[model samples]
Target: MPETTGDWAPADFERHGHELLATLRQHFELIRDVPVARPYDAAELMGRLDTALPEQGEEFPRILTDTWENVVPDLVHWNHPAFHAYFSTCASFPGMLAETMTAALNVNSMLWKTSPSASALEQVVLRWIAELAGYPGDSDGLLVGGASLATLYALGAARDAALDYDVREEGMSGPHAKVARIYTSDQAHSSVDKAAITLGIGLRNVVKVPSDDRYGMRPDLLESAIARDVAAGYVPVAVVATVGTTSVAAADPLEPISEICRRLGVWLHVDAAYGGLFAFASRMGGEAEDVSVGDSLVVNPQKTLFVPLDSTALYCRRRGALANTYRLVPEYLTSVHTGGTFDFMDLSPQLGRGFRALKLWWVLRSFGRSGLRSRLDHAMELADRLRELAVGDPDWQCPAPSRYPLVCLRYAPRGGVGSGTDLDDLNARIVKELNDSGEAFVSHSVIRDGYVIRVSLANIHTTADDIERLWAALNHAAEKCR
Candidate 1:
């Protein structure tokens, strides 16, 4: 007879499932339409969790409830429409539902035999996203936890391709002739450097090409950088271009960079962690059709899709290149059934993979392409509105007009009193003051020569009114500081 314990039994699970669903429904309702939490409760919540560990297990439901009561109240609610801190979003309803289902099924999509449907769905979803991203020609994809992992995986593929396919099975111990060099813009996310370092391609191997005035990577500068590296006998293996960079949403000149990469036979990887999805919505239409310029590409639906956290995708134009880089076959893991189905372990580093694709699939199907696109288009509209407001205001300044749904502005006080150092100090104080207030939240980042307040619009429920309230709060904070 099989041993049954705790809530694993069928009847027990059914009862718990219903109760848990009810509790979740209540929680979601409150989270979806309420102020994240009352101000001044951070210390109280932390103190409650400071209690000693129990010697025995408590009832699971009670523990769950305790977590909700104690832990959740302290969480910075991303779901709140007015939450403009950092790069974030209030994930969609379908994504939440899908996450629940993913956990319940709990299939690890490492190999075909482990979970056939899961592996298939992953491939299906990848194709769906690739098409949505406007990349043509034999592109393949696999779900990752987020953009960080996706970039890591993309570089691993680049590394394999650069090293002549010998590194996959023999590991890095073998005699490799090339000192692999990766390149990215100064404005590129720090992940590029981190990925290089983690992959044994040291940070020194990762070249930071200069960006143009708009904070975008200049292709001419990139070509010059590559030439200089080549002249120094450094093998240029990869060019990690940015579609939507971190500090500001600046797109690297992809067409020229892609042409250069093609001419040089270097692997191109575009890290569109925050901005790639907007390729589908570009006003330039045919001119913008050239953003997907690489052997591999990354898109973080989690960032823009209103998909919950921990959802990212990596795609390769040629599937064989990705699989060839990472695939390893020990005798136990070898598969003879190579008829049609794909094993995702060959494509990624994580062998024990969760069913992350389901959340995206659910969101896509639930909302359809038009529905999701509408939300994204709305975010762009909102960003433009914020830009207009900032530019129109004498007390505020929008740094530049680029892509994606963000406005980077610096608060300039009256009388030009705080023109330079004083203005920056005031802006810094303003960010803290608003965060401390806990009514409305806005994040800040320094760009170019001034301190900036970045209003990143990602939440679907955030309306023009919400943006208005956010701006009002910011002005009020500035006034208070003055």
Candidate 2:
């Protein structure tokens, strides 16, 4: 007879767990020998794994074997050393361990009463992140799935704070409420638009301010947009300044923008999802562009903190504002007496929250500030070297500025391409060839109506040699395309 579910003996559980871990270790050991991504037939892959469900128990070891042979080989390995694609993420060893523990000790951190350690530790993690980013020590923050959700929460808070009436009870049609307008640069993340839509602020109200030469949001343009919105009888609620723009990592002039917000009485939310790491290492403009200058900001650990995918910290200068924006207490769930402790459920929209703080705690403890700084510095240094190579090469040039470890370059040879040849087509072909070869992977962004290959180096395993390899491959592909 087949073994009953959840009835495995300790010996069986321990043995299978160890074996599975060994298999994973072996896979990483031979990772360098395998392609970054191997193309597979969709129908064949579906046919292999999409079989009919079985009523009987399946052998765990066999399932793992099948996964190793079939599923593992086909995935686009985002953690690979040569993955210079969209903002690389890593499941560092410490984070992996923490994740395992978190799963085993699955507890809701929505309330301190639910899990005291999880909720309390989350606050400590927030403080640690603020300290790392050189942000205001008094700022209160929380960990969410990612920056997208954090942005939504931030704008929601801004919307509520802007309205004189209680938006939580009366909704968007609150008494004496004017249409809310949010301002962000053309280069800012799409999350702003999404947040606007989700919060009843239509896309039309979210003005896309013009960007300057460096792809940063122009402060003067932002001021003008706010002025125009106010004159048109729309309440200028918030301005989102991107610290690391999606296209080129362009940092908006925060000091001037902050000045505008202060003078105009608008909430300023800094989206530092990609560039917040600079605060831990080398920030620009001294105190001028500090993230703390904004009323609120978000920093993503998944981007540069060597953590796993999807963890963002949203911080607010107004300690009670976030709670005021989202707190809803049900009678049965209400505390008998206020214990002077925070109930995380009062913080944001989530009620069933996971123990995400453990991962950051483990990673912070493992790598420490200096170790993380060293890794981030290395990535930036590699980016600088890559830029040097592009500048030194006669056939290539960086179309956009390289502020962070992300750079935008194009294969534009001076007096080399034949007349009537399209530069975009040529550069796209180069990227296609590189991806098809599976040696490396990169993405492209359109800047100045030209296709620019974007190489982002935020992965922990990425090294100078990996950058050199990608550079050589790029040159070879450019030659082939020509």
- Candidate 2 residue-wise lDDT, 347-389, digit = tens: 7999899999999999999989889888888888899999999
Top candidate (lDDT): 2
Question: Which residue pairs clash within candidate 1?
Answer: none
> What does each candidate score in C-alpha RMSD?
3.0, 1.9
lDDT of candidate model 2 versus the reference: 0.85
TM-score of each: 0.92, 0.95
The lDDT per prediction is: 0.80, 0.85
Each prediction's total of clashing residue pairs, residues at least 3 apart in sequence or on different chains, is 0, 0
